[model samples]
Target: MSLVDFSSDAFIVAFFLYCFGFLFYGVAIIGRKFSNRNPDEHMHKWGRIAFITSVLGFIAHLTFFFTRWAGGGHIPTSNMYEFMTFLAMMVMLAFIVVYAIYRKPMLGFFTLPLTVIIVAFAAVFPQEVQPLIPPLQSIWLKVHVTTAALGEAFFAVGFAAGLMYLLRVVDFNSKEKSMRIQQRWVEFTLYVVVIIIAFIGSVFAFRGMGYEAHFIQETVEISSQGVESTTTDDVKYSMPPIVKPYNSQVQSMDSFLGMKEPLFETPSWMKGVDAARKLNTIVWSIINGTILYGLIRLVLRRRIGAAIHSVMDGVDPEDLDEISYRAIAIGYPIFTLGALIFAMIWAYIAWSRFWGWDPKEVWALITWLYYTAYLHLRLSRGWHGKKSAWIAVIGFVVVMFTLIGVNLVLVGLHSYAGV
Candidate 1:
């Protein structure tokens, strides 16, 4: 087999091991005999074993990385799919380092699923390893992006830590029915995350092997001079859309059960067809996610968080808070130097400008500022408990927007990230 093939196989093996390790870690925290016995007595051993399996998975991930690097003749950090995989691997590595310090098995329960979800999300993008284009074909590209991802991985772990801290300390059991409903919604959001991951994964898994469906789309395009033009073309997509794009001519009688063409035309500058295609695909993914979530709710007959809470009897919110702080403390400076400093260096070489206030650059600054405020409140003002956790959670949301939202919603210098 080719090195790329080997890498793909290794990655698949690693994914299975990570899932198993996730399960094993859950078994560890819940203990052998539950409420009758001491929590995490003999069960801690299982935690160690789970860590071992994850380490084994990480080793395979490493193998995949090196093999793919050797095969591609460049680092596997160019595209979103590759970057996400690399980021997930780094998050696992960071989790391992933190686990060594704190020896917490429950951390794995949160972090592993996240890693799985991220890696699975990576599969949503095209997996083809194309040669690096100009501007992107730079040595500093590797240096700048690599450090940024490593820093972000620790930040991702901080998110997990913060989320766990909130779950444990959150006053969800309120007598007020509205407050209780809000709590259930919060719990429901977690499942939604997983559902989106699964929905995206299923789409890419089946369709990734080069699936395509063509539809004659009646696209309404607005020109720069405020001229409206209606153009029709056969558009191709990898996944089957439940809803067609706005004003699309239907050659094939596919399902348009609840889809409606919008009255407004696409923006003048925007590539209307591509925008429509992405929108349609995303809508279908959400539809699939809702169905999957409904099935999960039907099966469990309770909120996912409540079900997970059954085994969270012995978890420590304080430990979670501390780890979240520490992870951010470690990641911040590294992020500053790489994402900002080295990015400026690379940008100067590429665009002959240090900062142009591009959407990406703006969001990067926003992320930095958000985390900076987080550190300030955490250290100086002594926002150590629930407030800090909320900050950490919000910080990651900004990070996600920087990483994903900017790439998709706002096109700029970092448009390659959309790949």
Candidate 2:
């Protein structure tokens, strides 16, 4: 089998193994709370096992990635498959680092399932081999995608950590805070797992089938004379229009960096549609996925909501609010630099415009403004807790929109992505 196929097999195996390991770790947590066993005993033993398994999975995934890279001689982040793999790798690496620092395995409860879902989606849309498009051939492609994914992973960690903080603080007023805490963990795990499954299932069920174009035969008057009539029937398939290369090679910023023609042909019919659609799909997927998952969890854990409110009765919501800020403080600037400023700089060099307010560009700016407002709310208005967490969460939504929404829905220079 080709290395790509091998990589797919390895990834599937590794993901399943990780899932099993995650299940055990969840049991370990529950075993401590209910079994009257030493929580530390299980925490130390099973946490180590979970860590080791995740590490092994990471190594296997890396091997698959490296093998593909060696065989393909191209960076792996260029397509959906590679992007998901790359994202999982980054989240794993970040989680491991955080685990080492906090010595807390609870983060795994949130992070692992997320990684699994992303990998699962990656598998759903298997990687296909295609030559690198000219725009993706730059060394900056590696730097940009890598840094951006890393930034996103950190933001994800922040989200997980923030949620943990909320869970911990929520039960402060409870008569049995310690007792309820364990149950909270269980509920959180169940909720996350259910949400991921529901999302994947929903996407599978609702994914749009490609369109079918049909032609109908009809008779119409062909002339001013009443007797003259003609019958015509024409059918055309909804094929993307073909766009030929501008030349044998694209103009390069440096003479030493000779121009190379794009590997894939741009569809002429989609002169301005593809990129917008692609960006929109990305944005909508994130928003809809989060909303769907959140609603599902809310429905499943209706009683837990009341329990959570009771727990938070005496806790400082302000601290809960500020935790998200810590995440945003780190994530927002990095996101801006990677997703916007740096991208625009690259665009200027290639397309000769620093900012064109294209759909993607405009959405990015909107995301930037959203975070800017978030910071303003935190600093100027002294917001914290529920309000702040809400803002932080919304900020992520904006980021998602900038990253995926604009690329999919709005037509512009980026229309090449077949959004």
Candidate 3:
């Protein structure tokens, strides 16, 4: 096979290896009770095996990265698919570093699943290598994207540990108002995770079934000279449309589950062809996520968080909190250098400005400031355990919005990064 084709195959291998690594970690944790050997010995043996598998997966992922870079004539991080995969790989690297330090089997149980989810999410975007745009052609693209993603990977590890901290300490049996509030918020977080998984699953399912729809969207633009210009573009959907683009007509739409057309038109205020598609995707994700979450609830007859909390029984909340804090502390400076410093340097080169209030730039600043506050509160306010864990979790949410949400919802210099 060509190197590019080989790289694709290697990526598939890496993905399966990561999935197996997750399953093995699950076995290391959950199968201890079933084993005839001493529980500690069983967990130690299986955790070692799981860690080895994860290391092999990381190697394969690295092979994919370098091979694709060689074959595609650019670093494999110029698009959403490439960047997410690189982020997943860096998460694995960060996990390896932390796991080596702690030797905690439960960390693998949480981190591997996270790595798997991220890899799967990366697959949702187009994978074909494309030439970088003019703005992305500089050496700073490699420097900025890789370093920023590496820093975010540490944050992702912190998120896993923080989530584990919650599952470890939160009382599922408590009837107190405060505990109930905590339970609800934890459940909501799990629901959001399930929504992401559901969205990925739904995308792949419809893709496998070859579902598609098409539309012609007319965009009206006004020039500085007050000249009105109209442009029409073709928009395609891989899933059935629940909402058609505003002020656009259907070119052709395949019937789906007895539905022949969109149920509604996108609100006029939501401009761009992508806006309607993105809103439609959100609607589908929510619908499918609710159904999937309902099925899980039916099976367990308990909240998903409670179910997970049961497995967290022997894990220490204090250690998890410490790991979360350490991971974020390590990442914070790297993020400052990459997402802020290198970014401004590149912005100076590309846009001839050190700072501009672009939506992406604004959100990047928001994320940085939020994390800065996180560190401040953590150091000065003595926020430990649950408070620290919650901040870590919420901080990752802010990071994700800066990375993904800005691209999807707002148009700016970073719009090209969105799929």
Give the winner by lDDT: 3
What's the lDDT for candidate 1? 0.80
Ranked by TM-score, the better of candidates 1 and 2 is 1
lDDT of each: 0.80, 0.60, 0.91
Off by over 4 Å in 3: 219-230
TM-score, candidate number 1: 0.89
- Please provide TM-scores, in order, for all candidate models, with all chains considered together: 0.89, 0.66, 0.97
1-419: candidate 1 lDDT, tens digit per residue: 98988999999988989999998887787655453556556577788899999999999999989999999889999888888899989999889888888888889989998888887888778787878989888888998998888888889999999888877765555668865764665576575686677667657654655545566767576899999998788876665554455555545532233433332433334465567567656666677777777788789897666666666666778899999999888889988987899999999988899999999888888889999999999889999987898788878878888998788777788888786
Measured with C-alpha atoms, the lDDT of residue 83 in candidate 1 is 89
After superposition, which runs of candidate 1 have C-alpha atoms over 4 Å from their true positions?
A: 31-38, 176-185, 205-212, 217-233, 253-271
Instruction: List model 3 lDDT by residue over 316-378, tens digit each.
Output: 788999999999998889888899999999999999999999998999889889889988999
Model 2 residue 393 CA deviation in Å: 2.4
Better of 1 and 3 by TM-score: 3
Write down the lDDT that model 3 would get.
0.91
Counted clashes in each candidate structure: 1, 27, 0
Please provide, for model 2 over 86-139, each residue's C-alpha lDDT reduced to its tens digit, 9 standing for 90 to 100: 888877877776666555666675578778877776664536755777777777
Better of 1 and 3 by lDDT: 3
